[model samples]
Target: LPLKPTPPPFRNHGNFVVSVAELNRWLGERAEEAGAYVLSETVGAKLLVDDDYEQSGERSAGGEASGRDRNAPGRGRSTVIGVRTGDKGRDKDGGRKSNFEPGSDVVARATVLAEGCWGHLTGAALKGLGLAAKDPQVWALGVKEVWEVEQPLDRVIHTLGWPLRPQARFKEFGGSWIYPMNRPGETPRVSIGFVVGLDYADARLSVHDVLQEFKLHPLVRKILTGGKRVAWGAKAIPEGGYWAMPRLHAPGMVICGDGGGMVNVPKLKGIHYAIRSGMLAAETLYSSLKAGSTDFSSYERAVHQSEIGKDLYESRNMKQPFGRGLIVGGAITNAMVVTKGRLPGGHWPTHRDSDQPLLLTDRDKRYPKPDGKYTFDKLSSVFTTGNATRDDAPSHIRIQQRVPRELAEAWKWMCPAAVYEVPEDAPQGSEHVDLIVNPSNCVQCGAITAKGGRLTPPEGGDGPVYQVT
Candidate 1:
């Protein structure tokens, strides 16, 4: 690690890393074994609200399943009861194909939203149900790659500074991590990645490009001397801590995992918090059902009192100080850690990622050009993720196609999947420029959603097929 003054990392013998995708597959199998019907190749397009509920089949007048009456009482007050799966076999023009099948409503007594970071339905529920957090949720973009290294990395290594400027004016907040993937007998492998706060002020800062630059550092290059990059992907993380966590529950519904902003940024861990919150949600739902009650508010209370809430509360103001810059922010973070978040204790405010000012700095010139080996471009990076999105699939990203040149460049560099593009001959002035969107190139990282754009779910079974990430 090439950090200035070489700060000692918080090492623990209990810490270990595993393939998330593989773990998920194992969990799915266990769930199925427990009699849970796991539906594959399906997308939950939208949450089914009780006030506007509509079923797909015909009704028998005797309390049978059917579409809801639009004129029924409580039409304006809605509660999420379940989800509607996305329609399949629709052409690019949205016309029905021979095998077209309309989406069916999978109604449930209680719906739990465990959608990962920046989920589509989670955003809808937050806005439609008025589940507001005290502060707006902030985000970071993480681009990562796995490599088959020649030498095994015995332990985890984290680095700060070097690729990203540490000056207060830069407003860059992030770091890189390198971890050994396999044990003694297995092939030597390592997972290396970099994360950058989405609120960065530079108009041309690219999280992916920064990662390429980070790999070129002497300390990093030594680890990947003769290695070949295997898998690559990007994802957005919610770093707004406790104050930014939305109300965890609504009528007949509960939100869990990254969708509820349970991540503790400093520790760089959220899986445990997500798991704990999930267990509490399950208990609350079970009790509600057994008591024949419709209220799900108990779940929220349980979360606040549980370990997840306490952990987040202690680090609630951690990420906010970093908005001031790495040095001052780092100092404040250290002080807060020692004081257990009691130092400077009031709620700290945060700005939306898009609201951050994009200054016309020359930072873009510092990015390294890909050399084909250790560093690569976005298009090449996307290929390694096993992306299989159909070329003719409807666009899932929503943003103004025309915007100021500065914003255009920001989007162009911000995306790690090469989804956004500006014409090469476009004038570098204040005029609006046409931004081309290659939606098929998207890996469903959800970065756009955090940076002034919206990401809807693509057709089921499309997008990247991550196996070991």
Candidate 2:
């Protein structure tokens, strides 16, 4: 069942996939047609700078003696050197050599950084230019797998839903889906993955664990039961939103794609944004070069005015940790769209209920010993119980409600006292259990022995008794 009052779908399932090889071929053909030189597997090591030149009226600091006309002055030329390693060679230090030698450096009026998530080089270049900012808050981990189903391929279904683990917090976003790309009579293909937030980085759960649980859901299971996994991998997505975007340009360079942290969460994709950013940067560079100006300020202006920038700006207002809410919202919306004609009135109904709590909590049962000992739990129980018995229970009873000392003490008693006991020789706050059935002619039961004959509760007992040491 789906909820009513949903937003319109902004994405089409057909627009989501393209093979890497196919993409590369298309790019190669386009580059050839445009008469642009294309280099593959080359890494940019540094941006070459002629510090001898100044910007506008600014003075130059590092002047080159012979490369310039000893007295002539203005801004000197600057270019980027992309190094290509040659096959199996040795450096001066005798380190193992690379496949290709340093490739010819490209001299350009401006440069664009379109490198994806592996942005080390782009970041390094920016740092050299003193334009990089601190690391961004937006981060995403991509987990994906392609599956071939045994059943006939029918209509494609793209389902987005949260994982099924208790520790899978609503704050750390996750989703699953099945897409039938091939025609009927052909085996269906599906791709599923999730992007979790880094807020809980230290306690991060593996995407594999989430995926396994997702495949077990009734809706997902039906489509993927007999499917054979064909490919799987994960990548990190930079999602700091518009606010996390870094300095788009400097005097001679601009950063794009993952290097600039440009993923738009609302769009469920980043390739379009990445391409648009790159194209705009290229346009600005083309214009600056044509005017014989190395300044790249226009690139930043262009990006901010682009469609991608507008989308990012609108999405920035939405809060972080886009988890279950997105999934629930997407599912409800998509269901309504697909079933619009089948339903009466041609639309789902809607209602508003202010009396409901967004999340449910169990208060009648005692928590586990470890949790019960926590002060928050002790305080919460007392306050909730009192509030429930009030003349008219408050419409919203928060966990922050204060608990009186007496009520807190009573609630503490309901929790096992053993949880609060400290062993005599435990240094401090150490827990130990000891049983003493006798004082004189003691049997000296080894099971009841503590660090220093300290007596505490036995694991299993029928009566309550107290002993002084």
Maximum-TM-score candidate: 1
lDDT, candidate 1, equals: 0.81
- Summarize candidate 2's per-residue lDDT along 1-469 as a digit string, tens digits: 3423333333454574554435656877898899987754344433444454211211111111122221222232343423222222233333444532333445555667675653534544444444443433345444455667766445434444455232323344545445554645756676655544433222223343455555556876676676665554445556566655666665666788766767766445687878888888888878888898777777777877887777665555332423335555444434434654222222121111111112212312222232222112222222222211212211111111123222222212212111121123433332222221112111111111100111211111111211100
Per-residue lDDT of 280 in model 1: 92
**Model 1 steric clash pairs:** none
lDDT of each: 0.81, 0.43
Q: Write the per-residue lDDT of candidate 1 for residues 272-306, one digit (tens) a residue.
A: 87888889999999999899976788888898898
Error of 1 at 361 (Å): 2.5
